[model samples]
Target: MNSNSQAIKLFLVVAFSCTSLLASLTPVLAKPTPNRFDAKTILAQAKTFNQPPIPSGSPPKIRLRGGGKRAFNQPPIPAGSPPGGRVRGGAKRGEPACPTPKIDLTALVPFTQEANSVINVWGQTTVEHPSWFFYVPYTKDSPYTVEFVLQDPDANEVYKKAIALSDKPGVIRVSLPSTTPGLAVDKQYRWFFTINCDKQKNSPPSFVEGVIKRVNLSQPTLKEIETAEPLKRYAIYAQNGIWYEALTTLAELREKNPQDPTLKAEWRNLLSSIRLDDVAEEPILPGTP
Candidate 1:
């Protein structure tokens, strides 16, 4: 081969190798994203799972905060305050605002490995800090204190706050503030929703705990949700098994369109799918978390 020809061939070989290397590295860093589940496909599927493709067809066990196995048999919201606390949301005339028992503190999640009369559930998220929900059976006037704690995978404290809950009972949500540290993607996080009924605050408080894993969504998938109709976002989130955002999106929609019959039915169906039918018909109380 001529000198010029040989040099040209060498340069071409080097260029091809660099291209191949980049191609290989690209996939390693860029994980595969989920395909957009459009309205047609979502409608075709009658049920939306807490999370689909669960290995055992059941939810994975929730990660307990502080690795403690302590169980609170007492009601999360102890019943002691006066029975009459000014019925605000048309609560029944005779219904006990604070029941002696039958505490119905529930975490709004699908995957639950155990419920020892309290709650333990887990799910995934695509955002830094996602919102969590619960079905509170007590009114804001009820005698109780609320505390929410978030911990990282290493069990390190990330954010902790004592929330002041108001408004009539039903469903409520807690979202980490903008200043709170964002959850790292791929790392697991654990949270505790403890309602301290004891005046001491040191007693073993009844709580609902859940685990969360932050995942990444592809650019296209992100774009679709951001640009699509506001209500459509909920369906897409549900189809992808993103419980946190799905529930939040649905809740917000319900707040704006309380009379939306379709949303009302969907709210029931989503809760029913996870066997939370007891609080299925409960109102999504309007308020900031």
Candidate 2:
């Protein structure tokens, strides 16, 4: 072969080899899309609250965590009312003005067809201390009261407490105290968080409600949860479709590690997956005990 022809051939061979090597490495070098906590994915992998063989087939054992205190002298709802029913009335004349109508006061529940603006949560729990979360808009330190009411499937009030809101506006979590009665297995309970913008009003328009049904976790899932690292536990909960526990775990983690970029990103992604981007960027403020 001529010298020039040989030189051209060598260059072409080297170029072809480099191109082939690059093509081979592309998949390895490409970044995998970050895992997002999608509700559908959770539903597929995790057992639903409605599943049989309920966990701890008894009432949830309540354990006081020294934060949420029960309200005293709160009147019980009259008997024969609908389950998850609330008394309705306009705000009384003299109370902290209601939040701007534009404010999106929402319950941080799963994005399901069953969930509406009224705030409906789902999933199962084995713990007596299940916490609920809400996205309260920035009211510049405006004081608010969150009245938590728990009712059985028949709508009879089982437990109710009105917690005072002292934290800055953001995502706030209210945990039920251990003193409260435990939730029975395989039974659905409805809860409400009424933001008493005006105490005088019988029922403020700004309120949320959700349903929770406790179920037993599979043996393998429980084992995995027991062995999973603290940070990884949220993923486990999410994968199992335990909405309350997963959100609570991640929220607690973010509260402790406010500056952690990874946790923050995970929080954002999780919330965004449910179309809660409006309050996704809101900081996880220190909630009132």
Candidate 3:
């Protein structure tokens, strides 16, 4: 062979080898496998966001005597008085709100790990009206009336609804109706959920209450939420401190896919992060009234 021919052959051989090497790695590079979802990692990232501060003192205990109908429009428990006050239970202020002897009621409010029954949810400023979630633990399999009441910062009654729950003990989600008036931006509202156990006496109602505020979301945030994948959207909400939406989205997803172990784990992790491990294992039932 001539020198030039040999040189050309050598160059071709080198080029062919390089091409084969790249071809072998093409699948591994081009079709990269996605990382498995890590509940702890995602939760850690979420904790980096600015969450509302948990109240310092214990919640107040308000024991209901007789069938007296205290006005629902009363001003919220004074800020320095107590964080969350129980209606009847002798538990000190800042204690869990739904400490029913038989059942426990919990609001799906963020930053509640240290809070009593009263939780404060940091919402998006642009969101007019938002939904809320509750974890109700019932010892018996009987029908119970769940009452939801919303009061404005001025303690004015804004919305009220009574839902009849027939499902067995589990976590229930409550979405404010779009038809209802939207929450004003930069405003705080107090919400109360009571499980009317004794209808005839109406003395003590198993109840949980929390405060929610509406804040504005930046355009980039809105875009991210709109474009993010369904599974990842909740994490985004959590990282941004959008409590109501995060809990609601994960819950709705879990309800639709009851058998998804990943969703179940995510749900448990989400609740556990808030110190609600007790009710974390409860089933996510379909349809909330």
Candidate 4:
């Protein structure tokens, strides 16, 4: 090889090595930015955007005016029912009102009970005056035996009697008589009657209250029968086509001589003839003397 060529080659190698070394040692230049962001300002902005710190594990506290307790003692609530139910008012418990008594005439009369003589108006002692007669309608279906009870203002029973009712329909006349010969009248003597009927079919133990009425017997009157008279004698009897002076005359004859069929016929006839109006009519006035 020539000396000039060897020198040229050595120069080229050295130059290439120098150029590679310069390239390796050279610094890299960055591109210029339009706007700059400050670290301090960025840190402040991040702190503002961050979520608030979580609360501690505890319930919030609240203050009340009054203590924590109910105002009233509530009643026990029924299960599956509405609360505080049903406020109402009415009649007190265990109290029953008085019921009005009604009379049933279709039932049967009692034959066993006897009449009381203490309340007899025609007999010695009476409850009412002779002029006035308290009447009970005799029902053909049932014979009712009424017991008369005399009561004072205190509701105490002083006198009572069970009078057998007549079979036929007629007034069971009660004639009131004066207890004293002469005196002013006082409070009305109150007498009530109770009807005792035999145990009837399909009916409860039946009875009636306040059957008889009241009268002031002490009141003065013109008609005074000071003498005792039988109720049958005073009872006006209507028989046949004519009204008779007495009821028991036929009954008396039948009783005295039971062997006679005529007497029985006479009694039946008299009973059939007894008309209500015939007994009600006042006696005819005597002609002017």
Candidate 5:
């Protein structure tokens, strides 16, 4: 062989040797084995493993030490829970804290008399005597005493009293003092109810932050009619005893004067609408006014 051919033969041999070495070094990766243990065997192995004991202490506990695998088991909660503590409301822990009682003045107004018959038209006649209605809801240990307070807009207390012992929600009714006989008709009032839960007093009675509903006995008065021109028409309608037209005219008047004409006429119509009992006809109408 010539020198060049001999060199080519030598190069071929070197390349084959390098390829063989590389093939030998390449790693043959093995496949992972599938877990084939039966359920019973797995359970037995879990039983054989030892679990670490729980570190017992007060709430907000922190774990500094490592612990072995264990099933989750919670501590039992005590009964007659005190304030500021979590109470269970459902299957979940620490939910739905106890609710506070809310006292509200549904209304405060004058006692109207249609021939000595007091009215509660706002309550749709379901309520009588027209006193202040307060709704109180409470849940606490036995013998809870709550105070109800009535005051003016200026924060001058008008009435205050303590109510005792209820395991559930309750309604409190108090008669409005007729100090000035008709003072309640147009005046604004404020009220609140405080609780002494388990003989431990809570925050002072909270003020009901809303307006008080007032009552008026007569149809929009003469002065009110001037503010709303349509009311004069309604008064004339009522005065003319045109019942249907007066009723139809109300819708138009209501848009202009919701306070005076519409409300007053609505109330008067309610009084004349439903007759609770039959009235006996006087043989001759008792002399007309």
Candidate 6:
């Protein structure tokens, strides 16, 4: 073959070899890696945990509760009310005087539907001492008495804690203390977050309650969680149907790294997944014991 023809043949071979090599590596190099925790992919993987759907077996364990009025000590709903019974909503925190910040007290929880009459939401956790989060619009300038209560399935009280919000308006967390009894596995416990808006003597306070069950993590799932980095630990939890852990981990991460845009985007995506878009933008405060 002439020198020119030989050079042309060699160039063709080199080009074809490189193309084949790239084709072989496409899946490994270009495919999305689990550790990436991209907003779309991580949130899409979140389908594995769809905000703890409204369960079918029993009536909703969570509800707006307290004595209906100043004199009533019992829950407002009569005994044996229907499946979707109306629970009592305590006094509303009237419009405060200064600059009007967010006026509603909100729980950082997954809800089946929103209303003062009823609340239907349940989140699962693998840990015994799980932390509950909320957005408290009332600052020290416009404070409210907040209390946390945990109850057994029989409507009996388990642990009662009082929270003091002495800071600015923002999100706050209430952690089940080590002194309190750790949650029993597979048993649903009811918890109430109450804000006494008026602080009236013998008056019922505004409260929202939810049911949380502790479950044993599978061996393989536990291994995955132990090895996951901070960027993906929350995603791992969410993929396995652990709602409290998923939300808490991500919220803690976002609180610690406030300036990271990637974390912010991931936070928004996670909250928006379950229709909790309203309280997504509130600032997270340092949690209490």
User: What is the per-residue lDDT of model 3 for residues 1-289, given as tens digits with 9 covering 90 to 100?
Assistant: 9999999999999999999999999998999677555788667666643233345443222111112221011122334323343322222323433335543676655443234435333223246667777766663454456688988878999889876674476677676788888898867777888775554623455676766777666888889889988766776666555667777788888888988988887777666555456677877766775
How large is the C-alpha RMSD of every model relative to the true structure? Answer: 22.8, 13.9, 16.9, 44.2, 27.0, 16.0
lDDT of 5 by residue, 242-269 (tens): 3223333443444345456435435343
Clashing pairs in 2: 55-216, 67-289, 83-155, 119-209, 121-210
| Poorest stretch of ten by lDDT in candidate 4 | 105-114
| Model 6 global lDDT (CA atoms, 0 to 1) | 0.65
Per-candidate TM vs. native? 0.63, 0.61, 0.62, 0.25, 0.28, 0.64
* CA deviation > 4 Å runs, candidate 1: 1-103, 114-120, 201-203
Q: What is the C-alpha lDDT of each candidate?
A: 0.66, 0.61, 0.62, 0.31, 0.35, 0.65
**How many collisions between residues are there in candidate 5?**
0
Name the candidate that leads on lDDT.
Answer: 1
The residue ranges of model 5 lying beyond 4 angstroms of the native Cα positions read: 1-130, 139-141, 166-168, 177-182, 198-209, 219-289
Q: Taking the tens digit of each residue's C-alpha lDDT, what string does model 6 give over 224-243?
A: 78998875677667666677
Cα error, residue 20 of model 5, in Å, equals 56
**What does candidate 3 score in Cα RMSD to the true structure?**
16.9
Error of 5 at 42 (Å): 44
Best-matching candidate per TM-score: 6
Which whole-number lDDT from 0 to 100 does residue 168 have in model 4? 49
User: What lDDT tens digits, residue by residue, belong to model 4 across residues 182-241?
Assistant: 211332233444443433422222332221222232323213223313222222121111
How much is 103 displaced in model 2, in angstroms? 3.8
